[model samples]
Target: MGVFPDFDGLGGIGDLKQVIGALLTVVLIVAVLMIVVSAICWALGASHGNPSLASKGRIGVLVGIGAAALAGAAVAWMNWLITLGSQL
Candidate 1:
């Protein structure tokens, strides 16, 4: 009576757990990478003579935020899909 436990009929939150885990893993990796990339961009921007490099770094931070948000949404979508799939 697990509803959607095991696709193979073994058991567990079945596929939902794996789906969430994958999404979270992607988000975490992206977050860490973006943080490092942002720091580098800022540092390079500070050292560079051109104004655009600094701007690019600032853009990196903004993009990082966007990426994180997108990742979160993707995770949520995945959750929704799982829920929908289970109902089916």
Candidate 2:
């Protein structure tokens, strides 16, 4: 007997996948925007000799990068999980 995931086992699963894809797209767009804005803030802060703003901007940039990475990896992560689950 073959044991595999039945992706069509549920109704509205296609719609759910589409929604998740759209959300991921939005997240990536926002993350990129965040990085751009943060970089600009960092430059302005550094030019103005504002250490606090510069630090905040740096943190924001890092967060944006992390968010983008996570969003990008989400699909792979989920697929990995599903594969692992099926192996059990």
In model 2, the clashing pairs are none
lDDT of candidate 2 over 3-78, digit per residue (tens):
8777556456456567768989999999999999999999899999999999999999999999999987996676
RMSD score of candidate 1 (Å): 5.4
* C-alpha TM-score for every candidate: 0.62, 0.75
Candidate 1: tens digits of C-alpha lDDT, residues 1-88 = 5555555553455566786788788877887688678868778878876567777877878887888888788878877876786665
Candidate 1, position 11, lDDT: 45
Give the lDDT of residue 39 in candidate 1.
Answer: 68
RMSD of each: 5.4, 3.9
Q: Could you say which candidate leads in lDDT?
A: 2
